[model samples]
Target: MSERRRRIGDGLAVLAGARPDVLAAAPGARQRFVALGGVLLSTGALAAVSAAFAVGMALGVWWPLAVLVGLGWGAVVVNLDRMLLVGMAHDSSLKRNLVMAVPRVGLALVLGVVVATPLTLQVFSKEIDTEIVAMQAEAADAHRVALESDSRFAGLPDLRERIATQEAVVASGGVADPGLAVVRAGVTEKQAAYDRAVTLQRELDAKAQCELDGTCGTGDAGTGEAYLQARAAADAQTAVVTAARAELDTAVAAVAAAEGRSAALAGSSLDADRAELTRLTAELDRQQAAFDVENEGSGGILLRLEALDRLGGRNMTLAAAQFMLSLLFMCVEVLPVLMKLLLNFSPPTAYDRLVQLRDSGDVELEEMAQESRRTVAQAKEELLVLAERERVDRQKEAILARRRAALAEVAARTEAARAQPEAPAAEEPAEAPRQLWDTGPIRELARSAAVRTVRSVRRRPADRTPTTV
Candidate 1:
């Protein structure tokens, strides 16, 4: 059991290092760390790609660019997943581990959000659809108001009124201008005069035919006189009728010419122009009514976001449900990171404790070896300093000994010279009287002796070595 526990500890440590040896040395550890990491990365990648795809679809991006973006997002998420695990394994102490956990927790939260968004959107699809319909209607009404606000649109009613007035005039057989109405009146009077003239001509022709047929004629005079008189009266009446008919015909022609001009002007004029304006206005209204804002690409999701914000007062039950569902999904996404965090605080099982003890023993042994190496290195450095100090002291002692020997040799020479110089005094030269405390003569003698000794030493041969101390 102890051996097995030791093995588990070694495997865990190795896996934490993410070394290739994990495959050969600890297959179980390899599966636990490497395979699990792969699973996490795959899950994160799928979630990220799905999220990006949904956003692209909502925004109406081209399919190829959307796919490329999804792939990029997936790669980012995979890297984050790997980094999250690495960070989790980096610290052992509670405080330091918690500090390291911050970035991982934030990453997990973002992943959760990415994964949960689509689900939330799917769940609330019906509500979004209804909202879109209402928004479309509102947009249509707004468009209509905007179109009506235009100056040209505002003048449509006036155009319609003018059209109606013109229709009424046309129905009553009136021309476009008041002057054409006067011309029509003249035509009517000329028509009446022409009818009277035609009636007189018809009666004259019938009476003259009866008299010629001998049906009913008074024998007031011979046939010639009656005929002449009848003829003259008939001729005079015909002249009057001809003159009136000619005048009527001329009037009728004048009225016809005026009517023709009026009709021609009406065909090319006001009514046609008004009809065109009416047609154009109606077309504008139709276009305005058909306009729908909610149907625009990506507009639906924006509206959904609005609905979510307003859900609290609008639909409490649905809002609660959505919140709970999102939270549940988010927890699922963060479960692995949470597990790693909890593992840090958990007490080790018996086997794990045994493995930890084994690892601790090894660590202690390694620390002892390092301490021994440091001690040896420090002792070696101290020995080198001691050797250098001893060499300097030896050199200094040799120099002082040489100086002392030179002083002793000079004293010996001075003693010998004093013993051999007694016959050399210049007739006992008189000495100056000295004060009781004075030592002037003794100082003079010492100075002369020192100068003589220095000269003698300079004259000595280099081969004459001074005695050593």
Candidate 2:
């Protein structure tokens, strides 16, 4: 086999053969699938949005797309994040299958109803409105055409000719409108009669409605009966007017009797009517006063409650104090000394140079000062171990917190790193192979890869780089 193929085959064998059962039992497959799915989904999502935006731009309805276009990429990212979380959370055989199936089924159910119902309703409404408007328009057009075909309009030319003849007839004969004169006189007399009848009818109804119903609400039970009586009286008046329609009534005795009786009742009943009116007015005034008193009492109570709340927390003062002594004990700060002794050498939560210096056994003032400036170098192997551990922590945290929080172990290690002194810088340059670590181990492997590349390039140096600028 060629060298490249040999390397690839060896790598594959190493990956495929190592701890196969552990990977099958754990989240290895699901986690790898999640990463793969994220890449595929991201590409598809970007393509979908780009296509949608292009179509929207072509349609000239692009303004409505401002929000969807802007947020689509973020939505894809959120889904990718969700996929990773789920893959980690439910990576086992049955659990992964069950969990994934549920969301798909639920989404199908929701979308089936949500999308279909509104679309169906919209279509039905549009069809109904279109049919209704078309029917109304057709009816209107037919009605307009029938009115245009009326015989009255066809005879308008002859009518216009007679108008001049009528004008001449009026000019030749002075005051020639006997019909108008008779109509005017009849109208005036009928108007007077109508006014008198209306006045009498209103008086009867007002007396019944106001008195029997006790100012409209107190004794309103009799309102229906009184309204029936009013209707009967109106019917009787209508019958009388119908009989007299053609001026055919010549009953002078009946009319005289009605007038005489009406006058007699008005005169003798005046005192009774005045007393009834006085009684009704007094009852109305009493109800009004009672309602006003109740309303006013409730309003006064509300105002008092509002005043109490206003005074409850209207004024307050807040005070705070903090005391810190920088040098309460120069020999040994009182707090630390007491804490170290009482707590069995437990360290304080903050940075403290004095304790570190004391622990380092460099109590001399000059040496302690120099020690404060000293820094230590962490071995390259240690950093490599920590970085590998960090990657593993990140992968686990991605599962537990829905990729939301850093793992607890990662935080602890980061805090440990923060507590330690910084790494010292190098004072001299040196050539070194760089496969495994700067500290050692795989320098020979890096040197081998470098030699192979150099030899390959020298064999065909002209083809090593593209000719284009």
Measured by lDDT, the strongest candidate is 1
If scored against the real structure, what TM-score would every candidate get?
A: 0.46, 0.17
TM-score of the candidate numbered 1?
0.46
Segments in model 2 whose C-alpha atoms lie over 4 Å from true places: 1-92, 115-125, 128-251, 256-469
- Candidate 1 per-residue lDDT, tens place, 376-433, comes to 9999877866675566456556655654565576556556555553444456647643
Q: How many residue pairs clash in each candidate at the backbone level?
A: 0, 0
Candidate 1 lDDT (Cα, 0 to 1): 0.64
Using TM-score as the measure, the top candidate is 1
- The predictions' CA RMSDs to the true structure, in order, are 14.0, 40.0
Error of 2 at 304 (Å): 51
